[model samples]
Target: MTVALMWEARAVAGRGEELLAWVRAQDLAVRPLRRETFRAPQDRVLVITWWDAPYDADLPELPDPDGELVTRTVHRWRFEPVAEG
Candidate 1:
């Protein structure tokens, strides 16, 4: 089974870009990771990351998301892709 990991954060003033840039450089830590922009407001940012994995054990879970996730809260989603697209 494959899973998609979605991460979000609300960045402070001048931190969004810097934080995102840092994440992009962490290619060696996580594999098959893709980042996308959900929205961007002044002094706040909403971003989503998709990570392909074989199973839960193959994923990197962020226990303390607050460090990177600058929002009030964060969430995770697990799903199986539809067939016959």
Candidate 2:
């Protein structure tokens, strides 16, 4: 099966670039099949990693950034694909 892990965070005011750079620097202990990063208004950063594993399988995920860099704790979710084109 294929699973996707989503990690999202909102940086402190005017720190969007730093936050995006930090996310890009992170290295997962075990590499995923694919990974992508995104950013949006409000200094939000999102990272999605695709893996070939069971839904409940243990997997590596991005760790939380330093407290001074973000407004709140990070948010994460795991998903299994439901459909495709």
Candidate 3:
């Protein structure tokens, strides 16, 4: 099975680009099979990484950006695909 790690954060006021740049510069300890990034309204940034492991597996995650760049603490979630067989 494969797992997905979702990390999200919201920038403080006009610092969205700064926060996004920080996210793009991160180096993960464990490389993922694939990764994608998204931007939303309200200065929100979302990153999704796909890994070849279970949801409970230990994987390297993106650390929180500097305090001045974000409004609140970072949020993260793990997910697994439902089996059809």
Candidate 4:
């Protein structure tokens, strides 16, 4: 079954791109549905993606959110495709 994993992460000062870059380098992360949206100031971003498999990948370590507001949240959602409106 297809599943969608919503991942939100906040980056340190100017490290948003760095984090995205690292994930993009991963071979399994080439899924086209893995959309990434970066908030202005390049310090915060939210990634909501659909995957054929579960989100069981190794996540890179970044500065703690509590320390630098590097917030992160992960939620697993069962997803299905419907007729496009």
Against the unseen true structure, what C-alpha lDDT does each candidate score? 0.53, 0.99, 0.92, 0.50
Q: Per-residue lDDT of 1-85 in model 4, one digit per residue for the tens?
A: 4555554566676687775665444344255445554454656655556656544543322222343445454323344556689
What is the TM-score (0 to 1) of candidate 3?
0.93
Using all chains and alpha carbons, the TM-scores for the candidates as numbered come to 0.51, 0.96, 0.93, 0.42
TM-score pick, better of 3 and 4: 3
Q: Candidate 1 on 1-85: residue-level lDDT in tens?
A: 4455655556656677765554444443564465554545653443444555555556654443336535456556655556786
* Candidate 3 wrongly placed segments (more than 4 Å): none
Compared with the true structure, the alpha-carbon lDDT of candidate 2 equals 0.99
Give a tens-digit lDDT track for model 3, residues 1-85.
Answer: 8999999999998888888888999989878999999999889999999999877888999998889889999999999998899
User: Going through the candidates in order, what is the number of backbone clashes in each?
Assistant: 0, 0, 0, 1
Give the least accurate 10-residue stretch of model 4, judged by summed lDDT. 58-67
Mark the regions of model 4 whose C-alpha exceeds 4 Å error after superposition. Answer: 29-42, 53-85
- Backbone clash tally (model 1): 0
Rank order by TM-score, top first?
Answer: 2, 3, 1, 4
Q: Top lDDT: which candidate number?
A: 2
Q: Which stretches of candidate 2 lie over 4 Å from their true place?
A: none
Candidate 3 yields a Cα-based lDDT of 0.92
